[model samples]
Target chain A: MAGMNMISAAQRFHAYANPARFMALSARLLMPLAALTALLTGAGLWFALAASPPDYQQGETVRIMYVHVPSAWLAMMGYGVMAVASAVALIFRHPLADVCAKSAAPIGAAFTFLALLTGSLWGAPMWGTWWEWGDARLVSMLVLFFLYLGYMALWATIEEPVRAARAAAVLALVGSINLPVIRYSVVWWNTLHQPASVFRMDGPTIAPSMLLPLGLMGAGFTLLFVTLLLVRMRAEILRRRVRNLRLAQAGGAGEV
Target chain B: MTRAFFALLARDLRLAVRLGGGGGMAVFFFLVVISLLPFGIGPDRELLAKVAPGMLWVALLLAALLTLDRLFQADYEDGSLDLLTMGLLPLELIVVAKALGHWLTTGLPLVVAAPLLGLMLNLPGEAYPPLILAMLAGTPALSFLGAIGAALTVGVRRGGLLASLLVMPFYVPVLIFGVGAADAATGGFAGEAGRQSLLLLGAVALASLVLGPLGGAAALRANLR
Candidate 1:
């Protein structure tokens, strides 16, 4: 009975792993996720742009933090998502995991790009420089951006899906180790960027006025990422089906 | 097992030496890139000396990149890589041996050539020891990390650019500490800070020595599959 129960549990876990099952689940959740993302983002931006108090030090320029900081958070968070999904794919041979990992790369890369662009915008007002190569956060974030581009490029280069996924998994796992070293090494190398303001051991130095909208924006951006990920995964699954179908019609080869 | 590993390593070393397109080519590339810099930046010795550590290091890096794809592709194309997978030698150990061979042939020669290139960049005398030492400690990490990239791209035709793209970002920490170690000495602070960066550079080398083989083996297995 215990063995039977375990077998049933495993079956149920894998039931959700089916691409059709994933598509059904994502279809149901997508509207809700997108709606919530829109609502939170709307309220958050209103507060961020209008209601939040200006930093005494930064004045109006601190407003850029609303868009910049959340995207930065989401950008790194996106890579974390990719790396975790890649790990699951590698270990369990879950088709959904590969789809999820592949989908997350472009979204993560967009967020990284946004973070860098907004960061340069913020730097211009604050540091009197459009870009600061000496800044650790900037450089590490730039590295992280390239890592995303590289991951996506690997997927594009390998014609076979399984080969691409596995090779990308290796890259992602290796990147997980390298990311921290890049972060720390840059810090030790030189640091012109400001030290950690929020998420400090001493508690966030920013006022509650800023923190609330920032939280709202962070949560909103995360949901947006999730929504986008679901959409991309759906498209990828459909694309693969079309591919398999074409191959079948031509010569009856490939896994369906 | 050790004998098998060395045999493979010896074979690669011989191929790199006999072919004359590995170490010799990299040094020549190094020389050309360094020469181009003086034209781009003008003949200002003061500026050249100021930028020498970084300039030489970057040139060495790009030169190493020029040879990265051939690290695994030759054997892969000729079916030797398939034999390697079936051999008594573990794939991870094969990876390490191959990376070691690559370092000896390509990376080490670049280290030797960097000082000569550094002279062209007007590198200060005080910076030379730390520059060489930092690179000596750092370039092995490059070869090892490059092994992972090379392995992933082994099966793809004209994968050299893709391999460099995937690999160069990981070279950041190495580049940072390497330049830091050299610059710390140039600034006359070699006692404390320079030692710290060099130590960190060595630490990166050591870490890559382990992680590279694991990653390279994983990638090679994936490509073979």
Candidate 2:
């Protein structure tokens, strides 16, 4: 409580603004994080495929739940991370935050696409349709996917990194507002998709036996995202260094 | 300030008109895109009429997107953008004036030409008024929103495509509501549809009016630097 009051999230954020410090911290945590990610994902897949019982209705096909749900969760989570990182880049002018936000785009896009693909595969058997436009969650997820693509495309198309970051930051912030609307559009409008069952006011509807695997899969996916994020951040740091080195060499040549 | 705004607006309009093909290209592009749709879906008049309003709206949106690059590119290249950015007026007002110019050149001409295209596509009579109304209320939002993209990609080598890519996603809501309103009208629910969609379109235009210029100004500054 004292720590929370003493140092706000913004101030705490400033502490890691320095790229060298961030790189060092990421490097230190990388090994353990990678191990945890591998271990959890391996175990989660085992439980998901072998341990969790088939749904009474969905049968074996419901196994897609483990992958689909986690990917969907991460797609939204990735956007949340992007929005915060973009805000950090804009307000605090943190260099690492820009790198964090920029590097996360393609990864988030991949997650979104995976969620859509997996959801479609699941939908084929359960809903007896490959796609349903009336499902608000599904439509919103598609929009989210496009947003991810646009964000990445904005970055790739721009020649200047700083300008790209700024433009993409504005986009990221704007797109973040849609996340909740997407989540609730189903409830607000009568859609074909079911409402929240796992994270609702009344508590989770799934039995514990099924819940265990879902929870594990969720944890595994979260760990996997963090691991991938750290790797991407490190790669960006190196790329920035290379760019700086090239600029320095050019400067030296001009001086000569 | 008002004089400067009008002067700038008039100048841009004149320049666009003088360009010979600026206004016509958007209309032509709209026609071609809509024309291609029937071939792709097969020439069933009933289907075409059913989908015509949405198709026209989508084509207009894309046409507007395709031409958005011209919103600032010519001025940026010829140093007029710099003058406008550095001039005494605030950037937001200049943006509004520029957007007005854009609407006059691209959007207004599209609206004028849409009814003709509607006839070609056999759009139902009931759909025509709402289509024009939606376009009138909505295309300004496109110009305003597209201005930000135009400003962002103003000086890029192949900015036209990039500008489209950057702006089209932002254009989605406008496309949705514009087409939705047209669909409602054609489905005999025009009176029941009220002005909610139009209001939302206006809200988008208003929001873009505020943010568009700041973005444009920032992008302009970046290009100049």
Candidate 3:
């Protein structure tokens, strides 16, 4: 009960509602977060490559899992962030939420592409085929990549910022429903892909030795996502500020 | 609402027909695309027949998309969209009417011309009925959903390409089901495939019937601002 209360209570943490406050908070956290991300990533990569043993059957190619798994996780996490930010923007009209969602898109898209690329590389070595449409997970992820591209394209193509944000919000909401569909499509349909092992009712099938590096990489990649999101958000805010300043200067000149 | 709906539909149809090369442009574009495909893939009757249903459906989709922009573009530009919005009639009815106009000009003509092109590709003669049936069930959904994209991009200058980008992803399920139904008919599984695809298409169309107008109205309002 206490845990449930705590979780519910944390949901009200709208501290970043104000853009200036959010920027200040993000600026202060950026350097420390960047350092932590680098350190974790370095350690994670070393552990993934050297410390972890190769799979009994798959051998050295199992190393691809380090990059592929984390990136896949981050892809979903990025969409989660966007969806939550959009909800906040829609319900509370938080200005920062819109910026957060917009900035997160390109970063998410890059992560999704990375996941797909690494998955393909990994698949080629193990499955003996470069592409497999029968794999529901693979196909769903491809669809997701397209959806991300479409959402970002919609944002880029629109001239008005607020209108673009609103439209993108709708797209984000619509696309988020697909995430679950993608996750389950493999299991529900008898596809070529293997079923979930790491996440299931039966706890993880991975041994602790491999699990350690995998967990480390997962954490490292999540931290890296935060760092990139902050950097992009700062850039977006600065860009908007410059535009506002230019508009204001023009307005003053008109008054003169 | 019924009276206003028919009024708006009639007005849009008249304007679309009266516009220089309006309906003809979409038909010509469709014909040109169909004609070019045979040139690209050297004329092989067997291969053409095999791929005919998909080819005709894709061409029809592209041609239908080509004219969807005009559904609200003229009204949006001339401020008639605002007039419609401010009138006593609901925007949903107006959206349905506009979609009907879009279909009358774009989809109906494509359906009429599809049989001739299908014959050129040597599609089995029996496939024509289901092809037309699928389009009859499917194209309304395209018009309804495409209206949302058109309304979303109403005021933008280079909105045509963006409209296609925004609308094409939504069109995938329609394309899948429409072509799947036709393919099933060719493969002699028409009873199951045709029913399922048409049913799914109808469900999508019905969903859009409610959501499309709301989305279109919101987009139009956003553009006005």
lDDT of 3 at B83: 86
After superposition, candidate 3 runs with Cα above 4 Å error: A1-17, A182-204, B1-225
Query: Candidate 1, residues A114-133: lDDT per residue as tens digits?
Result: 99888877876665445444
Clashing pairs in 2: none
Off-target runs (Cα >4 Å) in candidate 1 are A1-11, A191-204, A253-256, B1-225
lDDT of each: 0.85, 0.77, 0.77
Query: Is model 3 an incorrect, acceptable, medium or high docking prediction?
Result: incorrect
What is the per-residue lDDT of model 3 for residues A206-242, given as tens digits with 9 covering 90 to 100? 6678778888899989999999999999899898899
lDDT of 2 by residue, A136-195 (tens): 555467668767866876776576778989999999998898767756753454333333
Candidate 2, B8-125: lDDT as tens digits: 9988888777654566678767766775565466444567778888888888988888878878888878888778867788877887888888888899889998886676466778
For all candidates, state DockQ relative to the true structure: 0.03, 0.03, 0.03
* Candidate 3 chain A least-lDDT 10 residues: A195-204
Cα-based TM-score, every candidate: 0.53, 0.53, 0.52
Clashing pairs in 3: none
- Higher-lDDT candidate of 1 and 2: 1
